[model samples]
Target: MRLEGKVALISGGAHGVEGEMMGFGGASARLFVQEGAKVVLGDIAVEDGEKTASQLRDAGYDALFVKLDVTNEQDWENAVRTAVTNFGRLDIMVNNAGTGGPGNVEETTEDIWDGQMDVHAKGVFLGTKHAIPEMRKVGGGSIINISSIYGLVGSVGSTAYHAAKGAIRIFSKSAAVQYASENIRVNSVHPGFITTPLTREGLKNPEREQFMLDRIPMGRIGDPDEIAKGIVYLASDESSYMTGSELVIDGGMTAQ
Candidate 1:
């Protein structure tokens, strides 16, 4: 009940390593709903998004699904409009829609690089740009931007993804500082090597799994629920005093 009486909007609610049941956004949305919050689920995957919303609604929770491609400005506007029109206010904005593309400096293509930036970096910018006004109207709210350990440090074969995530980290900080007086708190959550649908293949290989585990002090991968709990903390009044901060949930990988 951490988010009781709150309203949340989660992008990328339909996909990821968690699949439909376990995706970070999906879990966060469901958790918020279960905690007595109305949630608006947005994603490009219309079928899955609608299904998630329908399931939540059937469970007697307040939920809505909007077809949203985070990279599109008009789509962002429409999604925000749906939230306000349906729920009357927006209390939380989770900019969780993102893409991770493969590439090292030499292996990366211009198209791949641009795609990564547009989805991860620019999408966050657009989500915040549109959500802020509604949040301001409601007095105050929280903005949670999903980043990666790659944002804090680089890895092999992650050139484009790293750059885009790094940009998100700084962008969230700057936004948080600029909007603190307005009562809108902005923060980034950097997750390290979680086992999600997007990352299932890499984790399936025993050798690769061990390699990743060895890098983490915890010696294991993280669960989507763990990350969702962090999001809940940031989205609720429990984190009222926090802003312009990077919450690292990396399983001690970055501690090294």
Candidate 2:
């Protein structure tokens, strides 16, 4: 019960459905509830989000679903309100919503760049912005922004993705410095090639899967549950003195 009595709002929580593949948010929601926290799953995928929340409820956990477009301020407001209204208060905010940006600089267009920024950069900004006030109400809270290994290290492609995720990394540091006095901890999580719905399609190609495996020092892809455990540590009091740090769980991909 590391997160006992706490409440969390996770964007992109509908990345998977019941009895199907799961993403970081969905896995985090399950682990959080199991650790004794009430959870609110927020996403643009209404059906998947509702099914996930319902699945949790059926399993006897406290959970809810909200229609949230992370790029929209009104939606952020509504999601935050839903958390406070239903669960009483918000203690954690996981900015986990994202879209893939696969082109290089020359191939990347205005739309791709802007879209990447809107979801990865702007979305994290709004989530942190709104979560701060609510966190202030509770004396303090944890804000976990989901970044990528691409954020820390550059790749051959994904120019816009690297830019957006890099922004999140520095943005988290700035937020941590600004809010440290208030006890509101802000941090970022960077994941490697993981087995999620988003990556499954890409990894289906034998060569692509081999390419990823070859890069990882662990010689294997990561599981959502592994990343979820890290999130749990950050959300719980176990990391009480930690803030403005980057928790990288990439099977040692970045260490090289």
Candidate 3:
């Protein structure tokens, strides 16, 4: 019961595809509920989101699903409002929704760049903006932004993705400092080669899978559950004194 009595809102909280592995937000939501927190799941994947929530409720966990397009401000507002109205308070916010940007500088179109920025950078900003006031009302809260290892280190491709994720890294630090006095803590998580729906399509190529496996020092792709454990730590009081930090869970991919 590390998160006992707390309430959390997780964007991108739907399980990816019916039979596929879960995403970070979906995995995190389940962990939070197991730790005794009521969770409000927000995602645009309505069917998967509702099914996830229904499963949790059947298991006797407090969970709800709200349609959320992270790129939309109104969606963020509604998601946050639902958490508060339904659960009474919001204690943790996880900006974990994401889209892939695959292209080199010349190959990257203006639309691709803008779309990447809207989803990764703008989405986190909006989630933080709305979450702050409510967190303030409850004395303090934790905000965990999902950044990529690409945010910290450069890659041969994914130009727009790197740019957008880098924005999230610095944005998290700025938000952390700005709200530290209010008892609100903001941190970013950097993941590498996780086997989620977002990366599954790419990993289907044998060469691409080997490329990732070779790079990771541990020689294996990480699971969403592994990252979720780190998120649970941040959401709980276990990390009360930590903020403005990067919790990298990449099997030492960036260490090299």
Candidate 4:
């Protein structure tokens, strides 16, 4: 019951693009509820998002689903309003929505690059911008921005994604520095080689699985639950003195 009396708003909270594979947002929502919080799950996938919220409710958790296009400020305003209106206050905000920019610089279009920036960088900016007022009203809060291991290092075939994710790293730090006095802690989480909707198709082959494993010291991909645990720690009072930190849960990929 780490979050026994709290409320959280998660962007991209549906299970996945197809609603089957659990993404970080969805997994975190489940864990937050299990630890006693009322969660509001937001996503662009209407059917799948609603289904996730319904399942949580059926399982006896307090949850709500809202259609959210993270790029839209109006959509973000509505989502935050929904959380405060239904759950009473917003204690946590998880900006976890992202698009996989799947091409190299020479092959990627301006439109493709902008699309990734909209969700990964701009979206996080807007989420932090709006969630702050409500959170301050309650005295303090926690904001979690989901970055990728790519954010911390250079990678191939996704230059645009790397740019946007790296932007989040600095953005989170700046926000943390500005809000530390208010008790509002802002931190970033970097996940590596996790099995989510985006990576499931790519990891189907045994050879591909082995290829990814060879890079990780743990010799395996990560589970969504493992990352969720990290988010819970950052969101709860357990990490009361922490702020502006980057929690890297990459199985030692960045150690090298």
Maximum-lDDT candidate: 2
In model 3, state the lDDT of residue 174: 100
lDDT tens digits, residue span 138-175, model 4 = 99999999999999998668889999999999999999
Q: Model 1 residue 169 lDDT?
A: 98
TM-score of each: 0.97, 0.99, 0.98, 0.96
| Top-TM-score structure, candidate number | 2
lDDT for model 2 = 0.95
Model 1 accuracy (lDDT, Cα): 0.90
Please give the RMSD of candidate 4 to the true structure: 1.7
lDDT of each: 0.90, 0.95, 0.94, 0.92
What local lDDT does model 1 show for residue 122?
96
Model 1 TM-score on a 0 to 1 scale: 0.97
Total clashing pairs in model 2: 0
Model 4, position 147: C-alpha lDDT score: 94
Model 3 lDDT per residue over 1-256, tens place: 9999999999998983335689999889888999999999999899999999988998898999999999999998999999999999999999999999989999999999999999999999999999999999999999999999999999889999999999999999999999999999999999989998788889999999999999999999999999999999999999999999999999999999
Model 3 per-residue lDDT at 39: 95
Scored against the true structure, residue 114 in model 2 reaches a CA lDDT of 97
* Candidate 1 residue 186 C-alpha distance from true site, Å: 0.2
